[model samples]
Target: MFENGIVGSLIMIAVGIVVGFFAGFLYRKKIGESKIGSAELEAGRIIERATADSEAKKKELLLEAKEESIRTKNEYEKEFKERRNELQRSEKRLIQKEESLDKKMDSLERKEEQLQRKVDAVEKQKEELAQKIAEQKDILEQLSGLTREQAKDHLLESVKDEIKVETALLIKDMEAKAKLEADKKAIDILSGAIQRCAVDHVTESTVSVVSLPNDEMKGRIIGREGRNIRTLESLTGIDLIIDDTPEAVILSGFDAMRREVARIALEKLIVDGRIHPARIEEMVEKARKEVEVMIREDGEAATFETGVHGLHPELIRLLGKMKFRTSYGQNVLKHSIEVAHLSGLIAGELGADITLAKRAGLLHDIGKSVDHDIEGTHVSIGTALCKKYRESDIIINAVEAHHGDVEPTNIISVIVQVADAISAARPGARRETLESYIKRLHKLEDIADKYKGVEKSFAIQAGRELRVVIIPEEVDDASLTILAREISKNIEEELEYPGQIKVNLIRETRAIEYAK
Candidate 1:
C-alpha cells in the first residue's frame, strides 16, 4: 500500500506540473496581448495630436493671406480719393479765374462810356463859350471908336509899319480893292432899287354907279312917313335923297361901299310888297351882309388869280373891305390890283418870292378903309392889321416899310415898296401946291450958295440940279472938287428929295486976248 501511494504521488506531481505549465503559457499570452494593445493606443494618440497641429497651421496661413489682400485694396482706394480731390480743386480755381476776368471786362466798358459822355459835354461848353465871345467882341467894337481890325493895325504900326515895305504895298493894294468893293456895293443897291421900282401904274378914278328902273320906286323906299328911309340910313350908314330929278335918287356916304348897300336895300324894298320899318331894317341888313360876302368872295378870287392862299379868315374879310376904298383920287381897289400885278412882275425880274410879294402888294392899302376913322397913319394901321391877322413875317415887313416908315429887311419888302411907289407916282397920282414948288427951288439955290467960291447959283431941270457961277481968279480948279463935294453932302443931309440930285460945280478961266 505504501508503495502504491508513493507511485500515486509521483504521478500526481507530474500532472500538477503539466497543469502549472499550461497556466503559465496562458498568462504569458494575456500579458503579451495587453502590451500590444497599449502600444497601438499610444500610436493613435500621437497621430491625433499631429493632425490637430496641421489644421491650426493651415488656418493661420489663410488668415495671413486675407489680411494682405485687404491692406492692398485700402492703399489703392486712398490713391483714387486723393486724385479726385485734386481734380475738384483745380476745377474750382478755373471757375474763380473766369469770373474775375468777366468782372474786369464789365468795369472797363462802363469807364469807356463815362469818358465819352464827358468829352461830349466839354465840346458843347466850348461851342457856347465861342459864341458868347464873338457876341461880346462885336458889342465892344461897336461901342468903341475903333473897329477890331483898326485897333489891331494901330498896335502893329509902331513895330512893323516902318520896316515892312512889302506890307505897305499890300496895304495899298487892299485899300484899292476896298474902294472898288464899296463902289460896287453902292451900284448894286441902286440897281436893285431901280429894278424893283421899274413898273407902270393904271389908275381908275370913277366909281361904279348902278341905275334904277323907275323913279316911282323911290316912294316904296320912303315908306309910311319916312320910316323905311330912317331904317335904311341907320342900318346901311348912308343918306338917301329923293330929289325932283327924273327917275333918280341920290345915295351919299363917306364910304363908297355904304352907298352901294343903301341902293341895293332901297331896290329890294321896292320889289317886295312889305315896306315897314322892320322890313326895311331886314332888307338893309341882308344887303349889307350880301355886300360883305361879295367883298370876301372878291378877295378870295383876287388871291386865286394871284396864286396866293393860306391867309387867315380875318385877313380875308379885311381885304374885302379895301375893295371899295380910294386913295389920292384913285380907286383904291384898282390901285391894289395894279400894284399886285406890278409886284409879281418885278418879283420875277428880281428873283424874289413872287407869291408873297403879290400878297403884300394886294393888301398894302387895306388900312385905307379904316384910315378915315382910326387916329393913325395908314402905314401904321396896315402894319397892325397884318400882325394881328398872323400874316407871314415877309408880308408884315412889306406893309410897314412901303412908305419908308420902317426899313426894308428882305427882297419881298423891297419889291412891295417899289410897287407902292410906282402906283403912287403915276401921271396923275399927286398934285403939288405952288408953295412947295417954290420952296424946293429956293432950297436948291441956297445949298449951292453955301460953298466957298460960288457967286451966283440957279436951280434948273425942275430942281433936279443946281448950276453955280464962280469967279475963276478966286476959285482954283481943285476948289471945284471941294465945292461939288460940299454941295452934294448938303443936299444929302438937308434936302428931302425923291431919287437923287446932281450938283454941278463949273469954274472956267476964259483968257480972251483979242488980236484984231
Candidate 2:
C-alpha cells in the first residue's frame, strides 16, 4: 500500500508541473497578442502621420506653382509694355525723318528754278553780245576802208612786223651777251694754246736739187746715151733736168719720195765713180734701203717726240711716208705734229681727253699720205684706214669730223677740229692761188651787196673782214644788227672759208648845206 501512495504522489507532482507549463504558455501567448496590438496601433498612427505630411507638402508645392505663374505673367506684361513704348518712339522718329526729306526736296526744287533762270539770263546776254560783236566788226571794217578778211590780214601783218622787230631786238641782246662770254672764253683758250704751243712755220717745196762737186759731174750723170739718167728716171719715177744751171742738177717729180731716192742714188754713183748700169742699179737699191731706214727713223722720232705709243708697224711706216709728203706748200708731217701739240694744249684747257685728242690730231691728215694713191677724200680714207686698223669709233669719228664733213660726236673731236683749224690758219701755214684769193674777196663783197640798204661793201684784211656800208635812212639802229646778222648768215651759208670772218657794218649820214 505505501508503494501505491508514493506512486500517486509522484503522479500528482507530474500533473502540477504540466499545468504550470500550460499556464506559462497561455501567459506568453497573451503577452504576445498585446504587443501585437500595440505594434498595429503604432503602425496605423505612423501611416496617418505620413498621409497628413504628404497632404501638407502637396499644398505647399501648389501654392509655389501659383506664385510662379503669377510672377511670370506680370513680367511678360511689363516686357510687352516696354517694347510697345519703343515701337511708338521709333515710329515718331521715322515720321520726323519723312518730314525732313520733304522739306529738303522743296529746297532743292527752288534752287533748281533759280539756276534755270540764271542760265536763261546768261543765254540772252550771250546772244546780245554776239550781235554787238557783229556790229562792232562791221563798223570797224567800214572805218578801215577794208573788208573783214583784209582787215584781219592787215592786223596780222602788223602784229607780225611788231613781233619780228621785237624778236630781232631780243636776238641781238642775247647774241651780244653770248658773244661776249663766248669770245672771252674762246680767246682765252685759243691764245693760251697758241702761246704754249708755238711751232715754227716751214714751207716745203716739191722740187729736189742735187749739187755736183764740179761741172764735169753733169755729163757723167747723163751717162752714155743717157743710159744712167734713163735707168735712174725709170727706177725712181723722176725727171733729171740737166739744165744750163752750172754745178747743179734738178730732179722733178710729183712724188717727193721718188725725187729724194733719185737724188741719193745719183749722188752715190757720182761719189763712187762707178756710173755703169749695174752700179747705178746697185746704188739705187742702196739709196732706196737707206730711205726706208730714214723713214723708219722718222716714224720712231715722231712717236717718241709726241709720246704716242703702240702704233701698228704699218701705221708707223705710213706716218713716215707723210714726212716726205706735202700739201699746199706745208709739210704734212710737221703740220700733223703741230696739230697734235695744239690739240693736247687745247684739250687740257677744255678739260677733254688730251691723249685721245692728240692722237686724233696727229692722224687727222694721215689719209693725205696715201691720198695720191687712194681715190677718196682724206676724211673718208682716214676713216676707212682707222677702221681697218681696229681703231675706236671715237677716234674714227674725230678723224672724219675734223674737217666738218660730219658732226663732231665728242668734245675731243671738237678740240681736235679747233686745233687743226688753228694750225692751218696760222700765218704762212698755207697758201692759195691768186685766183682763189681774188674770188673769195669778190664773193665777200657780193654777199654783202645783195642785202637791202647796203650801199657798198669792202673785203679787207685778206678777205677776213667784210665792211658793209648801210643807208642810215633805210636801216635803223634797231634793224642794223638784224641786217648785219643776215648778211653774215648769208656769207656763212654760201662761203667755204678757213678761220672766221668779221662782219663790220658802217652807217653814216652826211648832210651838206651851202649858204650864200
- TM-score: model 1 vs. ground truth: 0.44
- The TM-score, computed over Cα atoms with residue i paired to residue i, of candidate 2 is 0.46
Overall local distance difference test of candidate 2: 0.87
lDDT of 1 by residue, 325-357 (tens): 766567776787788889999999988878888
The top-ranked prediction according to lDDT is 2
Clashing pairs in 2: none
lDDT of 1: 0.79
For model 1, which pairs clash? Answer: none
How far off is residue 149 in model 1, in Å? 74
lDDT of each: 0.79, 0.87
TM-score of each: 0.44, 0.46
